[model samples]
Target: MHYVKAKGILSAKNGMNLYRGCSHGCIYCDSRSKCYHMEHEFEDIEIKENAIELLEIALKHKRKKCMIGTGAMTDPYIPLEMELGHIRKAMALVCEYGHGFTVITKSSRILRDIDLLKKINDTTKCVVQMTMTTYDEELCRKIEPNVSTTRERFEVLKELHGAGIPAVVWLSPILPFINDTEENILGILDYCARAEVYGVICFGMGLTLRDGNREYFYRQLDRSFPGMKEKYIRKYGDQYMIESPNSRKLMALFHEICRQNEMLHDNAQIFAYLNTFEEKYAGRQLSIFDL
Candidate 1:
């Protein structure tokens, strides 16, 4: 890892990525795609030196407190977090300042900050979003090599539910001819149901491919599942969306299951939930004694 002072921290929408690049080694990670234009290797993380201070300044000056998002570009609970404790520090700031927070990760390591997450949610909102692409533990391990398996993430979701923290599941990038099957979707949905997740976000039953990510993915495919790259090349020569043939059937099942379970399946609705924030300490003044 290397440190560099950031020019700014928060995005126009109040999202922040305290680090650049990742070490989780998800084979289908879009962040590693060429379009993102990272100057360093993907495994070599870039730490933002002044991220905490920048966040403090932005939050203090904001007229309204909305959900502060992270882990969109890179998972905040990467292995480095175990050593750095930066994400926990950020959570402490968010809780102390009374701001809502959300994170999208595939790591069970997020459990380390459960206390702060509950603190934020008790007053405002704190959503824990995790991705579950493959239900089978072995397959999940191969694809999301360095991160927690889907079962481990399921346990995290259940624990979050127990803490009264809402959880969202991303069931996406479902590689075609690999995991694009009825069993895969059903298994993940079963996990979501048992965990009592607030929602499940799925963009059909396939994954995307582009210049940088496509090449790297194909290389991994060749190494792990020999001759699969040829099948992909033969079928989706240069496509981006890459939806699976089973999308229609699987989507029918997806909507049906979510509808029955009362989980949020609408992408727009779920995004709104993640972006929405309520101030717990609004219009309250600190007493001189308390101050």
Candidate 2:
């Protein structure tokens, strides 16, 4: 791990990444793509020394309360977060300023800040977004070796729901010929249903492969699922979007299940919900005149 001073913290849309690079070791991480242009190794996490300070400044000056999001390029709950406590501090800032909060992560470490999350939600809004790609525990270990497994994440989701915190699930980056099966998708959706998640965001039944990430993914495939690399090369040579052959059927089933469970499956609708800021006690607070 290393630290560097950041020039700015929040993006135009109010999103911020307190760290660069990750140690999760997910084989299909798109952040490893060349377009991102990281100067250090992917495992050597680069901490933004002034991210929290900059966030406080940004939140203090904003004219309107809006949702503050993270974990777009890097998960905020990475292992280093336990030591640095950056995410927890950021959450405190967001709650102090009366702003909504949202985070996308695959780590159960997020449970450490459940109190802060609930506090923010009680005041405004707080949404926890978790990514679940593989349902099989053994396969989850092979792909996402360093982070929490799908079952563990399910437990986290249930806990969030029990605490009255809304949760969303990212069912994405499905690997073709690997985890792209009815059983895998159904198992994950079942978990989502049981957790009573607010929504499930799934682009489709396949993963993307690019220059940097594609090479790394192929290497891991060669190591874990020998002969798999050859099959992918022969099937999708130099293709960017590697869609599964059963994408149509699987997507239909996904939509049907979500509909049956009354969970939001429309991507646009779910994004709108995540981005919208709500003040739960806005008109309910008693004023001096009312008293």
Candidate 3:
């Protein structure tokens, strides 16, 4: 890891990535695409030395107390986080400024900050978002080798729910001919249901492949699945969005199961909920006059 001074921290939409690049080693990572323009190797994380300071400045000056999100391009709970504690400091700033917090992570390391998460949620809102790609533990290990297993993430979700903090799951990058089966989708949705997640964000039953990630994904497929690279090339040559042939059926089952479970399945609706900040404890404190 290397440190660099950042010019700014928060994006216009109130999102920030305290670290750049990732070590998770997920084969289908879109952040590896050339469009993102990273100068360093993906695993050699870049730490924004000024992120927490800039975030504090931004949060203090903001007139509205909306949600502040992180972990979009890189998971905040990366193993390096345990050493740096940048995410913890940032969450403290968000709570100090009375803004909501949300993070998308695939690691159970987030459990380390459960107390702060609950503290933020008790006043405003704190939503924990996790990604679940493959349902089978062995398959998940192969696909998301460096991150938490699906069962571990499920446990994190259940713990978040027990703490009265809402959780959302990103059921994404469903590799065609891999984990795109109805059983895989059903298994993940069942986990979500059991965890009492507020929503499951799925953009159909396929993953996207682009220049940087496509080559890496094919390389990993050749190493792991054997002959999968040729199949992908023959099926989706130069295509960005590689949708599964059973996308229609898988998506139908997805919506139906989520509907039955009374969970939010629409991507747009889920995004709206994630972006909307709620002041759950507004006006709850007794005033000095009352005392």
Candidate 4:
């Protein structure tokens, strides 16, 4: 890991990434695409030395309390986070300034900051967005080798539910001809139902592959599945959106299950919820007259 001073921290929408690059080793990571233009290796992990300070400044000057989000470009709970504690410090700032918080991650390391998350949720809102792709533990290990398995993330979701914290599941980037099956989709949705997640965001039943990420993905596929790369090339041949052969059927089942479970399945609605901020005592503040 290396440290660099950041010119800014939060995005126009109040989202911040305290680090650049990742070590999770997920084969389908879109962040590896050249369009993002990272000067260092993907595993090198660039730390924004002043992210927390900039966040505090941003939060303090904001005219209205709003949701502060992270993990858009990179997961905040990467193993480096355990040593740096940037995510924890940023959460503290969000809580201190009365802003709602949300994070998208695939790591169970997020459990370390449950107390701060609950504290923020106690007065405002805190939502945890977790990504679950393959439900089979072995397959999960193969694809997301460095991060928490599907079962481990399920437990994290349950823990978040127990803490009265809302959680959203990102059921996405399902690899075609590998994990794009009925059983896989159903198994993940079952976990979401059991965890009582607030929503499940699924764009479709397939993954996207571009120049940089596509090459890396095929390389990993060659290493792990052997012959899988040839099959993808023969069929998809540089296509960006690699939709599953079973996309239509699986998506039908997905919507039906989410509808039955009463979980939000619309991406727009779920995003609106994540972006919206709420205060527990908006109009119930104690007045001098009451005292």
- What TM value does model 2 have? 0.97
Clash count, candidate 3: 0
Off by over 4 Å in 2: 282-291
| Model 1: ten consecutive residues of lowest lDDT | 279-288
Question: By lDDT, highest first, what's the ranking?
Answer: 2, 4, 3, 1
Query: Cα deviation of 141 in candidate 4 (Å)?
Result: 0.6
- Candidate 1 structure quality by residue, lDDT tens digits, 1-291: 999999999999888899999998888989988888888998999999899998888888889878999998999999899998888888888887778999999999999999999889887899999999999899988899999999999999999999989999999888989999989989999999999999999888898887898888998999899999999888888999888888999999999999898889999999998998865444333355544
Query: Can you list the residue pairs that collide in candidate 2?
Result: none
Q: Candidate 2 on 108-218: residue-level lDDT in tens?
A: 999999999999998889999999999999999999999999999999999999999999999988999999999998999999999999999999999998889999999
TM-score for all predictions? 0.95, 0.97, 0.96, 0.96
lDDT of 4 by residue, 1-291 (tens): 999999999888888899999999999999999999999999999999998989999998999989999999999999999999999999999999999999999999999999999999988999999999999999998999999999999999999999999999999889989999999999999999999999999999999998799989989999899999999989989899999999999999999999999999999999999999987764343356655
Q: Against the hidden true structure, what lDDT does model 1 obtain? A: 0.90
Error of 4 at 240 (Å): 0.8
RMSD of each: 3.8, 2.3, 2.6, 2.5
Model 4 stretches with alpha carbons more than 4 Å out: 282-291
lDDT of each: 0.90, 0.95, 0.93, 0.94
